[model samples]
Target: MTTAPPISPRLLKGALIGVDLFNPLASIIVFQYNPDTMTRRLEPRSMTGADGDRGEAYRLSGAPKETITLSVEIDAADQLADVNPVAVASGVGPSLAALEMLLYPKSLAVIANAAIAAVGGIEILPTSGPMVLFVWGPSRVLPVRVGAMTITEDAFDTLLNPTRAKVELTLHVMSYNDLALTSPGNALFTVHQITKEVLATANIFNSAQNLGTALQL
Candidate 1:
């Protein structure tokens, strides 16, 4: 008989590793752009009734936009554990300290400045209709919302769809290995004695900053 693999550091504070894609591939990424030089065309010559037709050329120069992509190496477990991160409000901040692929309990529409909007992004939640996780910043918290419909499974087909007990309601991020583990789902797995490692992290992005707080697995 084969034994199951031991879980990594114990499951802390209801956390899950998520990405739009499962089994996240560690990639080396960075988002940055050189200045953009724009040229304005001079206006066409037209008959001026009162004032001479005025036309001018102006140049706009600014940094281009790129989502910074960071690489995650599997062997550097020691370095990853040493990162001391800071916590911020649910909606505003980078999630360092530790690495998690998913985030949940989303908020409403996320408002970003013009620059933050230019890059590609993904929503971490299952119901946010796939958000955009751009490659532009350090470890950060990207807020999103999810529904139970997409993540849950219906049990025992019935006359009027009576198999509703298995409905999964909650948010989850894809694991570095494509796992949809979250709120009610975790309960399901644990209850069934699913011996898989809970790729779960703290529901709070900043919880990593306070090492003393352990997650509720």
Candidate 2:
């Protein structure tokens, strides 16, 4: 008798994608293991009654400000066991560096600014890093800025290279109001909102159907 092969469920990994504003360069850091839990908070942008305008109390200025906090764990035990060259050599240093670089200005830009300053030039503009997108899933991909990060190195290899670490990240969602109208981040945020609305509508429809069945109406 022939037996069917066992089916394996597909798993998705969350990632952070950084796209340069003026160049074709991009950085994608896929999480090794998905976080166990993610915390999200939203603050509404509604008009306040303190303005003495009762009519404007129900008005909203823009999309709510949203923030997400998650803790990601990184470990090199598996790689080290398999004798991976990079892991054996530097442990998780490269992985840690990749995450840390999200908040850093480009080295070339920093050098150029310093050169200009050395020449007694003023009015040098500050450098901005690439725009980062926090992608939890298809429906949850949104532009975000790294508000804060805390890294804890749990273990190290013989060379003092970190073998295990946990990174706690606070991401501030960038809504349309926070980005330029012509920028890609703005477009992405608009699509994200539309997707959310569509999902909410679907949820309501399902709930109505269940309610009708329950009431036999």
Which number leads on lDDT? 2
TM-scores, one per candidate: 0.16, 0.93
Q: For model 2, give the 10-residue run with minimal summed lDDT.
A: 20-29
Q: Could you list the CA RMSD of all candidates, in the order they appear?
A: 25.2, 2.0
lDDT of 1 by residue, 139-216 (tens): 223222332222222322222221222212233222212224553333332432222222333334555655456543
Candidate 2 lDDT over residue span 1-217, tens digit each: 9999999888899999888755434467789999999999999988775765887787898999999999999999999999999999999888888888889888889999999999999999999988898988887788999999999999999899999999999999999989999988899999999988998988998998999999996
Which residue segments of model 1 deviate by more than 4 Å? Answer: 1-11, 19-92, 95-145, 148-217
The number of clashing residue pairs in model 1 is 37
Which 10 successive residues of model 1 have the least lDDT summed?
84-93
Quantify all predictions' global Cα lDDT against the true fold: 0.28, 0.90
